[model samples]
Target: MSDGVKVIAVNRKARHDYAVDETYECGIELLGTEVKSFRDGKISFPDSWAEVINGEVWLRSLRIAENPFSSIFNHDPDRRKKLLLHRDEIKRIARKVDEKGYTLIPLSFYFKKGRVKVELGLCKGKKAYDKRADIRERDIQREVSREFRAKLH
Candidate 1:
């Protein structure tokens, strides 16, 4: 088996807004049209999240645009898609989510072995100060890398 998954998109803002504790790769149940839409890069992860219900995980608020050329049928852009995860993993996620200030956010979407997979993160919301600090640290690192490159030139 190869680990070369074709990543579709990553939620860059999710990392900036939340402190991710762990990540889990889970399969997504999608319609044929929805899969085609994703292949065309017509998917958005804005405000998307995972939820454990009835001992199963489900993705909510994911937007996969319809295939405009297909007039006969169209998949809903926003639908609750089921996620394939083990029972123990679901239990662990449920427990983590029940804790105060913890959340389940979608980190990225990708295709692994011809299957659509979503990377879900167990995260805690970051405070305003934390966001500012991250921004400052990123700027400092960017400046250091630039100086290092200039010296090599």
Candidate 2:
């Protein structure tokens, strides 16, 4: 099968704030109207997260706009959606979270093979110094690239 995945939205802030250790690609369960609205690029969430509860993974805080054409049959804007993942994988992640300093965050949202998929990251909160150091390193790399480009001219 072709891997023609179309990315829908990304939570860039999550990467800057957390150090990701592992990632999982999951299929999301959505209502018909919700999916319609999502296709129009009307979905976003600032503090979204995933949690393993009762042996299942659930996505919380995701906001999908109501399709204007749906009338009174629209789905809730902020609803908990189930994520499809292997049982063993869920257990493994749960163990890691219970150990402390680990969190489950939605890294990105996309469509794969005409279906909605989410990239979940197992992350640890980064310290203030860590973020500052990352900024310094990025600046250095950018400056070096610019100097080389000028010299080549």
Candidate 3:
């Protein structure tokens, strides 16, 4: 939302692996060094997921690289980070997660008004056949677009 805010990393695989139904933006609880590392674009969302515990949402498995310039105050690269969200939102997410085969995945990480935020999604795992179908459809669409562009030219 702020002028300086930028998206650092996105989990592109999440869209291919799961069908995301809804998305929510939530703040991340980060240490000083972790924020610095994120600002430097040293973050990964691979294998990162969100879990609801004790009526709160937490981010797990995200890797934030250590700040190279930090002398003595480096945070753990794989520590679980708490996500700040409203109680109603947490409850809704928890309820959805309780359903069979539903999951919460981190889609992307970005900055808003100088604060770090994560885009979380309610997703269901996709089958292998579905992935293949998606690839085929994308190829068809690309070909069609190319043909149309050629005609226009």
Q: Which candidate is the best by TM-score?
A: 2
| Clashing residue pairs for model 2 | none
Error of 2 at 113 (Å): 0.6
- Across 9-114, the per-residue lDDT of candidate 2 in tens digits comes to 9999999999999999989999999889878879986799999899999999989988999998999998899999999999999999988768999999888988
Candidate that beats the other on lDDT, 2 or 3, i.e. the better one: 2
Please state the error at residue 64 of candidate 1 in Å. 1.0
Candidate 3 per-residue C-alpha lDDT over 1-153 given as tens digits, one digit per residue, 9 for 90 to 100:
458778888899999999999999999899999999988999887788989999989899888898888978888898999999999999988988896668999998898888888999999999999999999999999999999999999
Tens digits of per-residue lDDT for model 1, 21-138: 9999888889999999989989888799888889999889898999998887988888899999888999988988987657899998888888888889999999999999999999
In model 3, the clashing pairs are: none
**Cα lDDT listed for each candidate:** 0.90, 0.91, 0.90
Overlapping backbone residue pairs in candidate 2 total 0
RMSD of each: 1.9, 1.6, 1.5
User: Candidate 2 overall Cα lDDT vs. reference?
Assistant: 0.91
TM-score of each: 0.91, 0.95, 0.94
Model 1: clashing residue pairs? Answer: none
Q: Which ten residues in a row have the lowest lDDT in candidate 2?
A: 1-10
Q: Candidate order by lDDT, highest to lowest?
A: 2, 3, 1
